[model samples]
Target: MEVPSSEELLQFLSSCLSQIKWRLKSNSKRRLEIDVLALCTGMRPVVMIDYGGKMPELQNRLLSLLELIREGLPVFKDLKVMVIEDMIYLINVRSLPKFVSSSLDSEPELFFIDLEQDPPKMVTQSKESNLGMQLRSIQKLFSSTFPLDDSNTDTTTVLDEANSSQTSLCIDLSCCLQDTKVTIPTLNGWLLDYPVVYLFGTDHIEEAIYNLSTKSLRLFKVLVCRNGTTEKDSHLEELTSAI
Candidate 1:
């Protein structure tokens, strides 16, 4: 989660400007990379994205561009804000690339691109932002991406065992817990307030059971039970009974 050096971000902005001008004539996909970077820069939120085979060239370009910014823009080093929009991938068990910074006030700001009508704002190179501020911001971003506890040895072992099984699957529960307690019931109610729940799983089922047993059932919702393997059967039952 390295914050783009002010010079780096600015160079990206410059490259984006070039693309924006060129793509204005033809339909272009900017939301994923350039536009994402633009929106992230404006909000001063940590930008997160994964590197993939398709974008090796772009990744290298971005890396080089960042080095350029480090040399060019000293102001970005201290800046304490940025925006990030990207996917997450677990390429390695121990190390991964991700932006992990907290929001300025513990409440991060994010903006999703509107591909239909609202377009990204145009940015031009300027000396308005302070280099130190930018760099600090980048540091904050890198700190955010810093690794959390790697003490899930048991979980990793379970996952490894599950992966070896034909039916076993490991669903990411890290995203579910705020402080380790799954706020599934409350979250379910929140979701019931919405029109749909596209993702469903055993954890949600566990939550539903908890809500029902507590006489505080949020709403009636369907939970899809994707087939589980023998290894998962025991864990699933434990999760099921815990609810």
Candidate 2:
């Protein structure tokens, strides 16, 4: 299979953005990378965010790409926004609440990157490892804020521990979040309320969807929205804005 050219990828990205009404930021940073890549395939810069690993080279490459893109399309450098924890929260802040309706913690987001589709992975195993390392370091740094019952456990540790191995990483949120209460036969029903709730393993887009679906199974109101999307990227922004 042939890898997608930078021009092709840019076009595809543009088309996607256009569908969502996102105007391409006209700035040096966005255009420079494309121009440079058009001139030399060897200079193609890739940006990858791997939650499972760490790679310093990936960071450096991203910086290079940003610099190049800035040189060509200056508006891009300022267009990107970063948010943490809550995808819905970001949408709310943007006043685009409609896209967030399905994106509440109950519905979360699901993103599938098919290798068979555009942009075949340029990120190597080494780069993935580096990204993983960086993630671990970050987790360690923020461990206190998001401490796990067992820090050494895998991301799906709660599912394995709770379901006695019957569950995969695809377990329900109630289980993963420790929201379900199992009392003796006297009160053998799941509790409706929880306090000081800490939801772990929800960092990935896939995990978020799973959690949302799980909560849905429990009949809770959940919203699922794609990350970083807003009025520019969705019609749902209309409904959100109306409210």
Candidate 3:
């Protein structure tokens, strides 16, 4: 398989976004622009869209977009489309397992569409084991630094301990941040910068903390953005530069 150059990847994604926007304006008769957040793990691209409570309409549009992508971009033919509430996630199917395993706490209710089928069919899976997988991954990361007690092997108990000592763990890991070279991969390739953090509310703040605390050992870096005009604009600017 041929790997797409950074410029090629970016151009493809730009075309996809433009197509989505055209569809929205033509079908909905409104200029409703969805916010997009793009992330990449190595060469794999994950595109997240905030549908702004217009999920039903966006979901159908995204499904058509997925089909278009499969036909246009052979590199991303196996990309999976998922809708959880108002958020729509488009990621390569091969990357799904790793993405799901890295998620913390309550996993999003993932509804994956089988694009190969006629009209595409939705496949729903149980999210019950997501927490367990996340916890185990965390345990492995922390095992060398904070050895787990052999006697207390319960997952819940381990999670409670980690939560309680989150502050101390962060303090200890602060020194390593300076030495770590964290870069977020983009459609245009990797860019070295502080990680961009978006806080929607109190819930998002907690989620940010949990992720940073647990993943600090693995080159976790972040710059928090509130709703303030300056900060929000700066975050968008940073995203633009990164991409």
Q: Give per-candidate clash totals.
A: 32, 33, 0
Q: Is candidate 2 or candidate 3 better by lDDT?
A: 3
Worst 10 residues of 3 by lDDT: 183-192
Best by TM-score: 3
Tell me, by lDDT, which candidate is best: 3
Provide C-alpha RMSD values for all models, in order.
Answer: 21.7, 20.2, 19.5
Candidate 2 local Cα displacement, residue 56, angstroms: 29
Tens digits of lDDT, candidate 1, 89-156: 11111221122323232223222111111222222113222322332343343333333344423333
Model 1 ranges with Cα > 4 A deviation: 1-44, 48-53, 78-243
Candidate 2 Cα misplacement greater than 4 A, ranges: 28-153, 156-243
Steric clash count of candidate 3: 0
State every prediction's TM-score relative to the real structure.
0.26, 0.21, 0.36
lDDT of every predicted structure (CA atoms): 0.30, 0.28, 0.37
* Tens-digit per-residue lDDT, 142-219, candidate 2: 232222343544445544454464212111222322332211110101011111111222234354345444442233
Off by over 4 Å in 3: 14-47, 51-53, 102-243
Which residue pairs show collisions in model 3?
none
Model 3 lDDT tens row, 112-143: 32222333334432432332233234324333
